[model samples]
Target: MDPGEPDPEPGRIEVLRRRLAQRHGERLFAEGALGPRRDLAGVLAYVLALLVHGVTVALVVAGLLLVVLGWGQGALPVIGGLLLGFAVVLRPRFGRLPDDTPVLRRAEAPQLFALIDEVAAVAGTTGVDAVVVAADANASVTTYGIRQRRMLHIGLGYWEILTPQQRIALLGHELGHFANGDTRRTAVIWNALHSLALWHYFLAPVPEPDLVERITNWVMTPPRWAVYGLLHLLDQLTLRSTQRAEYLADEASARVGSTDAAAELMDRMLVLDSVEVALQRESVIAQTKGGAGTRRETEQGLWERLAARVESVSEREYERLRRVSVLRGHSADATHPPTHLRRRRVSEGEQWQAAVRYDEERAHAIAAELAAARDRVARVVISDTAC
Candidate 1:
């Protein structure tokens, strides 16, 4: 799988699946004991995903066969016909969801794209196909289209809040997701899991199942149970793997960016969530009270105020942060290693050349350049919230 080569087709999703498995194998060899058990877990997840799909198809086919066979038999024909009709209505549809995130063209933010390119080069990741600016306070790289072209999404909330150093570190971390093969791999697995969920949603017993509906439950409950069992198994295999992937991604960021920068970014993330919550509350209040100014201005004011809140975290807040166990790896329920662990990893690590410039002047310029896109995203946030 050459990084330079284009992905073949929408239908060749299975090839990507194979490539993901091979990538996992290469990772195992490259990482030795330090590698997460995720490759195997990924393999298992992909396999189980396929198995679930196959079993679903097979069961549908079997039900159809039962219907055809039952037609000749006495009472079984009626039962079979009913079951076949039930399956038809309850089948899950496989359609891709549209990308609602606001996309930023190179013309709109040439500087941001250039920055992304610089970060990607240092992080050893492939080129990005698109850049998305959204209203949230985080960043990620994802794949879309038949060719599985990669896109990077920057959350305006976080973008406005993070320092230049933190921004570079965050971008490096997101690009690292592509380098570690987590982006494309996770995309497939997520879709698989989603398909199962859709299946369960459609097939689960209805509110008022008549006798025929009861029969549908009798026939479908086993497969529904199977889906649940497989979902749980997939989670067990992949949860820790997800946590490890996060750690590896951070290390990748540290390699390209500074460890201290990355560590500080993680620490800031602990409080960013709180900041975002406050921003959301303020936005709603402004909207409700019909305060002066356009939604965009209110959004801007709320964002500025929220940034101020982040800048002035009280000693009590610091103490609360210190006491926070969830941010320190206390919960296995989370996908990422806790904030404390990530900060420690980066802070204690050897320093490296900064991948992108992090001076105050450049930071200010970047913020100015992104101001328009940020305002547009603010409108998006307000509109979404109002709905």
Candidate 2:
């Protein structure tokens, strides 16, 4: 997708919510709101989230009661069994960790983990359980499984382009999500959204030729629309808080890495298109020069070359990208405030001295730890491009 384009997957309801969110986000910033807060909107968000969850819970309980009451009976037991089975479909889904990504362990990357620990301390969040490297030009922190174990995903494309301080800023921003109190990320609220989404998915009308199937779809349509409406309401209620959390995360980035570094990081985000082009160019060059060279020879210093390409971006080019962002209202996504606003806010916020610093020696050690992962990611990039 283009930088400023609305995400296609969200469809119409989310598009409306995004517009409302953008308006509310601008007002929040204008009013100098600092971080997530428990206002009237927040209370409504929680109530709506609980109400969604409560519906599922009530259905399950009713199913279980029917099963018990109808034991050894005929139709009631069968009906209860069906209800229980349907309730299972409404259960919360805790996503699994990526099987294909390179999982970096603390033992394998001590220095890197140490840096993460320091950043977490400064950001006032617990450290991540693991780090995973991917091929995308983005980084994020997410929870997985019932334990909600934290995983930090680093995109080599994004990671390689950042300077050490900027990297710290990036980490600060991601880890800050945990501390920022974004209601959407909370298990109660998130699971409610998940359950409602499942309802929408299962009840959605589909083309069916069989008479019975057509009737079933017809029966399900009303409930499907109802779920859709509830989902829209929950989303709208939480939208402001979600956007506020992002600004708070940006604040954490500034507090941990210093305001200047965080601001520079936002500037770097504006030029991610250049990062992608550089990655593709390097991949193509590697393929062209791959006659008799060994794998190591082809992949060695791949990240360094990419970093150099990013560093070589002229000030004039950076300014041009900034202008384009403003013109386009470019953001990471519809949910996020515009990139230019985030950059401006960070720059204009209180100046903070670096709370966590990485000197040259430590930075080199951390890079050394990432060597194997870097080679693996570089090979993947080349192979993907080849395909």
Candidate 3:
């Protein structure tokens, strides 16, 4: 099949299986290379990371040395240098890791854990340490602990909309990140880049709480500029590498599930995301009409009602909405690639028979099993904590 064209043949699954086998035999992903250019980019990303970290070390050492030298000079110099050194030392650099979401324990939902284990085993990784649910319309796998314990986060908003097949595809794609080493490779490098960018915020020459810090801010401005400049350079070089990683993860989804299912999931996610905006608007309107006390009444039959509302949307209307949707084009700095590109990449694989399928029964079973936890989470997510 042509790269741009869809595969309609009954043997599409068999074709994909052969392609995956060929890729394995050739070890195309051994060093994380889907193409020669991507391989070169991967090497460049590591080299860039090392160079950036070296500069950070130099800055820290320089700060410490200044502290020592200033101490030898005089009290005023010592105070200034010591304070500046501390700022450099203590300024946080890494992005805030994903940890605020509510946790879902195995005891509360063994069925969900079972599904996660199945996907993780297929992805060739140790099972996840936790399953979390959040208010978002996205699902992801994150790391925690010194051992980098994997945690799976299922966005209940998104979960309510997906079919069984799409759920598997989503989990498979996330686990694929673990399986393909994307998480480990980018963990330190991306964190370093984020830290570099963040140092600017810490050292920015803004008004400070104390007189000493105000003075320290003036001295630290130069380092702040340097960090930001390096951050820009690194982001430019690594953008393609990040995009490639996402593509590989999508390919992994295709391998674990099916290409058609993955593509459909991507397409549906965009539609559902758009539809959710309308749903929220309606929810607000209902709140205004009925009052805050009536919220429970509104939420009682929410999903079934909303699901029907979504299903009632005409295809032409959906296509029209999607044309102007945020999912239309690639985001410049997003962690994932554009939905269209991702859908296309997965769909481009060869046609085969025996494609995997997920029915409504499993989807309902998983949802029913986790319904109680989902309710608690939904309350926390959708309501005011003050009340």
Decreasing TM-score order of the candidates: 2, 1, 3
- Give lDDT tens digits, candidate 3, residues 1-387: 112333244342234333333333223323344653345546666787777666666666766766666666757456656556745664434323345556766777777787777766765666677887765566777776656666787776676676677677788788877766552245667666655655666666766448887888778878877776666556555555555566777776766667766776776665554545645654665557666656666556555555666567677765654454333342212444555555655776643221334556666777787777566654543353221
- Model 1 earns a TM-score of 0.73
**Minimal lDDT window, size 10, model 1:** 325-334
Note the Cα lDDT for every prediction shown: 0.65, 0.82, 0.60
Give one digit per residue, the lDDT tens place, for model 2 in 239-293: 7888888899999999999999999898889877767877777677767767537
By TM-score, is 1 or 3 better?
A: 1
Put down candidate 1 lDDT per residue, 1-387, tens digits, no spaces.
112233234322233333333343334334434464446767877787667566556657767777787767777766666655655654443332236756766677667777888888888876686787777777777777666777887876776677677788888998887776552246556666666666667668877889998998889988888776666666555554555566667877777667777876776776655666776776676677674565656766655776777878775765566457333322212345455555665676567667677677766666677777667766666655532
Clashing pairs in 1: none
Q: How accurate is candidate 3 locally (lDDT)?
A: 0.60
Best prediction by lDDT:
2
TM-score of 3: 0.71
Cand. 2 TM to true fold: 0.84
Most accurate candidate by TM-score: 2
Candidate 2 regions exceeding 4 Å error are 1-10, 58-85, 207-221, 273-298, 385-387
Candidate 2 whole-model C-alpha lDDT, 0 to 1: 0.82
